[model samples]
Every structure is written in structure tokens, then in C-alpha cells.
Target: MPKFLIVGATKFEIQPLLTYFKIPVHSPEGLFSTESGPDISALITGVGMVNTAFALGRYSHNLFDYIINAGVCGAINKDLKIGEIVNVTNDTLSEMGAEDDSEFIKYPDLNLPGTNYYENQVQIISSALNGLRKVSGITVNTVHGNEQSIAKVRRLYEADVETMEGAAFFRGCSRLSENYFQLRAVSNYVEKRDKSKWQMPLAIENLNSFLISLIEELEK
Candidate 1:
């Protein structure tokens, strides 16, 4: 049996996955253990890159055949409405490079002074999610809203979605097993923070449907 891992920023992101897979939630770490449904596991690491990297790295060591970092992200492409899913093809920490004078430095790929990315597993994961709805992801430490940062990222990486944890999780998995994936469901746009504009509830509902299909596909 191939052990599968699922890491998310919060319980809400992993709730549909857990329920659909019938995995019991473990507190403190939100690690769910199961023997059925692709032999998958789930964890709800708190928010941010540091916690997400640590939680996923610790949980993924020598234990899983495949690791999935699944969660909610802010969409940049207006075409992707809230509740749509985005398959991360590759992740880059959009805000990692150094800034000098007035120009932002472009550090070598996967060579950020303090960050990480899994180059090997990215395409493999992308292949698995190939036919699914997708948009490239660029992870950022800061909660983005300004048009300036959005333009920079769009120009630099050509990413359609901006997320907080995908790059961190991918970086953490670099030394671990080689099969890792990331999927994000858009809950809101990377715009002015407006609670009324957030589609969290709808995103969760859509996530439930996505997980059901994903599990079925992976099973076969």
C-alpha cells in the first residue's frame, strides 16, 4: 500500500479531504491516520511558511509514497472564480530574492538564500493533475493585495495564483520522498481585503467535490 500525505494550512482546507476519505482527525497536529482510500493521511498545519514547512517535513519522512499539499489560495487571474481549483505546476517564493537600490534580484532557481522548492516532484505531480483545472502558483510570505506585487509576480513567474504555503511545503519535501503534489482551491482574489468578497464557504463545498473525484481517480 502506498502511503499518501495531505498537508493544509488549516482544518477547514483539509476537512473535505478528511471526511471524504474517512480519516479521523488527530488534534494538536490534525494528523489523520487511515488504512483505506489510497492509504492516505492528513494534517492541518497552522498558517504561514515556517509552520507549514516544519509540519509537512516532519510528517512526510520515509512514511508516504506521495505527499500532497492542498489548501486555499488567493487567485490573481480573474478568469478563475472563487471555488475553482488550481494545480500547482511549480512553486517559487515570489518575495524571496534580495532587493538592492531599486531593482529586485532574481536568485537562481531553487537557490533562494532561505527558501526551498522541489524540482523533481513538481512535474510528476502536475502530470497526475494534468486534466484538472489548473493555474500556476507563486507562493509569497506576505498576504498580497497591492497591484504592484501582483504585477511583479505575474511578470516574474507568470503565475495565475498566489499562495502562502505551497513553496514552503515543496521546499520541505525536497529531501524527502520524490512524489509530492500541491492543489489549491481559490477562496478569494488577491485584492483589497474584503470579508464580504471572500467565498470560503463556497470554496469548501467545491473542495468536497474535487476531493471525491481525485480520490476516485487515484484509486484506479
Candidate 2:
């Protein structure tokens, strides 16, 4: 059986999938794996870029065939429905570059050799879950709730979703494994800071359900 690593920002986001897989809690602070079959494992990499990079770097000695970064994200594109699961084929480190006066300067603007973005060819095309849109995402240290900032980022990237740890996850996995995927569920629209409009529960439900099915397919 092929080994797989499932990563999430918080325990709450991946709790359902862990429970379904019956992966017992081993360490309170680090990685854990299932007792039987397939070498399926889970890691909760706190939140944001620094924590995610550190977590993956610390425990990435073992090799895995596939790494799945799963979480809830804020949807920038209005066409994406709340609670819809999406495959993030590409992700950018949106706030990695410097800000010159009122203008935001990206890595490319600085003549950097490497890119601030990462792309993967692995896709979610299982028959069990159909019509899950594949989209581009931007990972930011701070999620945009202000209209001005959101507008600026949307214009720059033309991305569909935004998450705190997507880019770091992609970077870590791409360096450590050949097959990597970023799967996200739309929890809220990128509007003003409105908790009332966010469908977190629905998003978590759909995300975990899809993850469970995807794991089954991969194991077979």
C-alpha cells in the first residue's frame, strides 16, 4: 500500500476525517498514523505560513507517495458555492514580496530567481465525487477581509480561493514528495468580516466526506 500524508491547519478542520479513519491520538503536538493498513497519516500544522513550514520540515524525513493538504478556505470567486470542495491545482504566496509605498511589489518585481507560486498536476477526478471544480488559490499570511486589500489581491492573482497555509503546504510537499494535492472547501465568501455568512460546519462536513472517499479510492 502507498503511504499518504493528510495535512490540515487545525485539529478541528481534520477531526472528522481522522475519526473516520480511526487514527488514534498518539502525540498531542505532532504527527500521528493509523494502526493498520495503507500507512495513512495526519498532521496538524497550526496556522499560517511559518507554522506550516516548520511542521512539515520537522517531520518530513519519511517518504510518502502522496500528500493531501485539506482545509476550509474563503472563496474569492462568487461562482464557487459555499460548502463546495475544490482541487487547488496552483497556489501563490500572495504576501511574500515587499510593499513599495502604496504599490505591492512581488518576487518577480524584485528579479528573484524562484517563483512565489507552486503548481501540481495531481487532480481529484474520482468517480465517487464528481464536478468538484479545479481552481487556483492564493495563500496569505493574513486573509483579506478589507475591501481594498481583497480587490488588490484579486486583481493581481485572479485566484478562486484564499487560505492561510496552502502555499506553504504546496512548497513542503513538492519538495518532499512527487504527488501532492491541495483540497479545500469553501467556507465563506471574500467579503467584509462577517462570521454570520460563513458556513464552516457545512464546509467541514463536505470536506471530510470527500476526504474519506478519496482515501478509500487511493488505497484500492
Candidate 3:
């Protein structure tokens, strides 16, 4: 049985899956298995890049055959429907650069050697998860609420969705595990920060349900 790690940004994002699997709640600092018979474990790495990196780093020694980072995200592409889950094959650290006056300069623009983006090479498109679209994403410390900022990011990267911890999760797993994935559900559009328009419940429900199915397939 291959050990699996299921990571989420918050309890709210993964609560449905936990309940559905009947996984008991445990300390967030360590890994715990699900009651349902597979060697699957989960972790809630609080909300941001720093927290995610730290949490993963703290548990870097643990062995996991596959690491799945699951959560809800805001869609940058209007074509993506609410409650739709997608596999993020690539992710960028959108704010890792300097701001010169009104213009933002990226790390690559500075002729930097380090990369600001990470790609998942072991992305598997099993029949159980093939229905979800594969898309690129951008991770930021601050979510896009201003139209001007959103447009700036759009010009910089062809990202389909935006999330707070996706890039960090990717980068961390890139160093720790050979097989990793990011699955995100679109909860709202990236145009403006309007909670009124966000379908959070629907997104969570759909995302968790898909996660449950994916885990079951992976276990087999």
C-alpha cells in the first residue's frame, strides 16, 4: 500500500472529504490515516505560502508515495465554471519580484537564475480524474481584488486560476516527493473581491467529492 498525503489550506476546504471518509480529526502537526481502508493521510497547512512551506518542511522526512494538494481557488479565466475542479499542472509565484514605480518587474526580468515557476511532471490523467481540466495557475500572497492588479498578472502569466498556496505546495513537493498534484475547485471569478458572488459551498462540496473518488481510484 502506497502512502498518500492529502493537503488542504483549511479545515473548511477539506471538511467534506474528511467527513465522507470518516477520517478522525487529529493534531495538525502530524499525519493521520483515514478510517476507510487505504493508507491515506491528510494535513491542513493553514492559509498562505509561508505556512504551507513551513508545514511541509517540518514533515519532509515522512514518506509519501503521492502528495495531493487540494483546495478551492478563484478562476482567472471566465470560461471556468463555478464548482468546477481542475488539475493544476503548472504554478507560478506571481509576486516574487520588485515593483518599479507603477511597473512590476519579475524575477526573470532581472536575469535571475532561480525559477519562479514549477511544473508537475508526474501528472496522471486517470479515467477517474480525466474529466477535470488541466490548467496552469498563479499563487500569490495577496489575492487579486483590484482590477488593475488582476490585469497586470493576466499580462504576465496565462494562468487559469489563482490560489494562495498552490505554488508553495508545488515547490515544496518538487523537493520532497517525485509524484505530486494540485487539484483546485473554482469558487469565484478573479475580477473583484466579492464574496456575494462566490459559490464557496458548492466549490467545497464538489472538490471534496472529487477528491474522495480520486483517492479511491488511487488506492486500487
Candidate 4:
């Protein structure tokens, strides 16, 4: 059976899947069998890149056949409605380079020490992922809440979504496995701070729902 690792920034974000697999909250890390599907495990890496990197380091990557980074994200495109799930096919650390007064220079232009952007190398993990919108995303140290910064990022990356951990998760996976991908549900638009407009609950619910479907497809 294909062993899988489901990585999330927090347990609540992935609670539905954990419950679906009948995997308890505290012991989702080790290999488990559900009596009907492949062996699976999960990791609740705390928020942000640093925590994710460190959390991933605690495990042996060689044991899993697939790794899926799951979370909620802010949409850059107005068309991507709240609670809609999308596959982040590519991601980059948006703040990895310095600002040249007015124009921002990317890592490639600055000749950085390590890669700043990554594309999904994993071809297929589950057929359930085939029909979702494939989108480009940018990872940020601070989520955009200002109009000026949001516009600048829109012009710079042309990204469909923004998240705190996607790129870091991608980078970590680059060294750990070749069979991994990220999936995110839109929680809100990348606009000024407006907690009233955010739909975090819906995003989490939708994200876990899709993950459950994906796991079912993997069982077949």
C-alpha cells in the first residue's frame, strides 16, 4: 500500500480528514491503517515556514510514498470565491530578495544561495485532484492586508493565491520527496484587514472535504 503523509499547519485545518480516517487527534503522526485503505499519517506543523521546516525534519521522509501540504489561503484573483479548493502547482517565497528602492528583485536576479521558487514535480497522487483549478501561489512572511502591498504583489507574481507556508513546504519537500503537492482552500481575498469578510470556517470545511475525497480515490 502507498504510504502517505498529510502536512498541515494546525490540527483543526485537517481535523476532518483525521476524523474520517478514524485517526485520533494526538497520534496522527505514525503509520496507520484504516481497514479499507492505504497506510497514512499526518503532521501538524505550527504556522509559518520555520515551524514547518523544523517539524518536517523530525520525520524520515523515505517512508512515505506521497506528501500533501494542505491549508487555507487568501485569493489574489477575485474570481476565486471563498471556500473554493485549488491545487497550488507552483510556489515561491515572495520576500526572498531585497527591494531595490521601488522595484523588487527576485532571488534569481539577486543570485541567491538557494532556490526561491519551485514547481510541482509530482505527477499524480490521486484522480480526485484532476478537476481542481491549478494555481500559482506566493508565500509571504506577513499576509497582505494593505491595498498598496497587495497590488504590488499582484503585479509581481501574478499569483492566484497567497499563503504563509506553501513555499516553505515546497522547499522542504524538494529535499524529502519527489511525490508531493499542495492544496488550499480560499478563505478570503487578499485585501485590507476585514475579518468580517473572511470565511475561514468554510475554507477549512471545504478543504477537509476534498481531502477526504482524495483519500477515497487513493483507496481505489
lDDT of 3 by residue, 37-105 (tens): 777778888889999999899889888988999999999999999999999999999899888998889
Query: What is the TM-score of each predicted model, taking all chains together?
Result: 0.84, 0.94, 0.94, 0.91
Where in model 2 is the C-alpha error above 4 Å? 26-28, 123-125, 128-131
CA shift at 6, candidate 4, in angstroms?
Answer: 0.5
* RMSD in Å for all candidates: 3.1, 1.7, 1.6, 2.4
TM-score, predicted candidate 1 vs. hidden true structure: 0.84
Over 4 Å off, model 4: 27-38
C-alpha lDDT score of every prediction, in listed order: 0.73, 0.87, 0.88, 0.85
lDDT of 1 by residue, 91-201 (tens): 777777677797777666436465433343355433337866655777777877777866776677767788788888777777666777777878998876787999888
19-82: candidate 2 lDDT, tens digit per residue = 8888876554478899986688898888888899999999889798878899999999999999
* Model 4 CA lDDT for position 52: 83
**lDDT score of residue 65 within candidate 3:** 88
Q: Candidate 2, which ten residues in sequence have the lowest lDDT sum?
A: 122-131
Candidate with better lDDT, 3 vs 4: 3
Angstrom error at residue 146, model 3: 1.2
Better of 1 and 3 by lDDT: 3
